[model samples]
Target: MIPTPAFVVDEPLLTLFAGRFEAALERHWPNSILSYSFKTNALPWLISHLRNRGVWAEVVSDHEYELALALGYPPERIVYNGPVKGRERLRAALAAGSMVNLDAKREVEWAAELGREQPDAGLAVGLRVNWDLEARVPGESATGAAGSRFGFNVENGELDAAIARLRTGGVRLAGLHMHRNSRSQSVDVYRASASLAAELIVERGLELDWVDIGGGFFGSLDDSPTFDDYVGAIRECLVGAVDPARTRLIVEPGGSLTAVPIEFHASVVDVKWVGDNRIVVTDTSRTDLDPLFRRRRPFAVDLTTASSATVPTQIVSGFTCMEDDRLLTLEDERELRVGDRLVFRNVGAYTMSYQSTFIELPPAVYVRDAAGAYTRVRERASVSDYLRGNSWLSPES
Candidate 1:
């Protein structure tokens, strides 16, 4: 059996959802492609599963780029993203025939150099456009928002200058990319971005291969938008502006596509009360699921105990010594007992991506496959697991 605080992926559910999501997008925009966001859930198994289904790797780091290569991903199927572009990494990606999106103007300079080096390669590249659609989001301060630091500014002549630099350097500007922060809540944001991108292409005399509307859509929400809704919105913007038959539209999806399918479970280890307030300590902490309290995502609570009405008011907490370790508070008190499992859903996004040994190190993750087979993907970490790289540890110590 798997140990406590399990991060489980229903692999069967994953395949089903992925197929459904892909079909949803294809139905709307047949020319579109879904590039899996590696930064979101780069689990090798997860990557392999998606890659086998024909999803491209949308990576933002040198390490992730290398991982994609190591995992047998055809370099051509990888989209190199992110604002920080290391020279060697850029050269490697360019050499490997991966599609590279130049984020900042400095990277525009780098792209020019790469173009000069591989002048005969006829290096076709993409430019990530940073635009201010002024799409309003509640509780977000876009007023003074300088906009995200990634990509070239379209408002100023930065985008034009980058294009000129690349063209003069003999590199073909093949595509446009723009991904807003998660605060972008409307498809209108995409319409505006596409509209502006198309306008710039005409004004600057540019040509392309694919336009990547980076991922952050609210996927699988009952009342929210669906994959079709997002792709439809994108198609509306790109229909006449670009040739769907010739140019590909690449979409990188993250939490929206991958979050809801997986769930995390932490077991209760202690129970206590301070007057009318109840504190239920669990083996898990925010470290396991960082977004637990940050967002109002729904979770299931199981108080493993015989039916009783004498339970204390609930204040679920972690084992951490900090006072802020409280996970959540219940409006009504329930009979809770130690050893009960507390399951948190919609935590599949970054919980594992951001996990660290804050207090107690976690164990190997368990997976229930699509065929209903259970397997251990990783071994549980011991105390020394955290000290493997520490120089302070010695044979004597």
Candidate 2:
């Protein structure tokens, strides 16, 4: 039997979501790229699964870029993004015809240098556009007045200069990337971004090969916007200005594609009372599931209770020693006895990507097939497992 405190990927659910996303894109924009955001959940098994299904990789770091390559993604199939792309890797990606969206000044410089070096290589690159999404969407942006720190700022004339510099250095500006995290993930948020991309393309007369409306779309939640809702909004804004026949529409979905298909299972091990408060301690820690510990919203949970009796209040806590390592509070619910299991839903996005080895090592991960058969994809990390890469120093006797 698989142990408690394990992550289970519902394979049927994952296939359903993946098929829906791909079908939505095909219906709205036939020439579209549905790239899986690597930073969302870079588990090797997850990556291999998506890769087998023919989804391209969208990575944000040099390591992620390399990981994608090691996982059998052709450089051309990978979308290399983020500001921390190393110089050597950046040059290699450009030479290999990867979709390298230049986010850092050094990247622009490197692209320019590569342009000068390989004038005949047809070095086409994209520029990530940083516009004032807050002003347009009004409280939709996560960055608010501070604005997003990524990409080249549109308001500061930096984008204009970057464009000119790249062109002067012989690099063809082939696409525009407008990806912003939103608080609302509403149709209007995507509408505004697509509108801005269309505007920039028209105003600059940029004949681009692609227009990437970056991901943050809500996926597989109650009353959440679906893939169709997001793709339709983008197409509505860009159809007149950008040709679907010529320019490909790219979307990098991380949470939207990964969040709902996996679950975290933790079994109740102990129950205690302290000063009128009843605490339910589980075998799993918040670090294993909610690494950020910033989720204020209640998770959709299912309880396998050992009793039919009810409780007024029960503070669901994790195995960590930290006083505040609480997952959530159960109120006016069934009393959870020892051996009861709690399953947390819609936690597949950043949880696994950010899961750490703190007081305990990583837990085993299982993928449950459509027939309810469980197969272990990753074994639980032991002490020796965790120490695999570290150097051990022998003490001098």
Cα RMSDs of all predictions?
Answer: 2.6, 1.9
Best by TM-score: 2
Please write out the lDDT profile of model 1 over residues 276-347, one tens digit for every residue.
Answer: 887889888877777344655435554455546654368888888878877777765556778766777777
Give the true-structure RMSD of model 1.
2.6
What is the clash count of model 1?
2
Each candidate: what lDDT? 0.76, 0.90
Q: Which residue pairs overlap in candidate 1's backbone?
A: 174-208, 364-380
- Any runs in candidate 1 off by more than 4 Å, and if so which? 135-144, 291-293, 296-305, 310-312, 370-373, 390-397
| Model 1 C-alpha lDDT versus the unseen true structure | 0.76
TM-score of each: 0.91, 0.97
Candidate 1 matches the true fold with a TM-score of: 0.91
Worst 10 contiguous positions by lDDT, candidate 2: 388-397
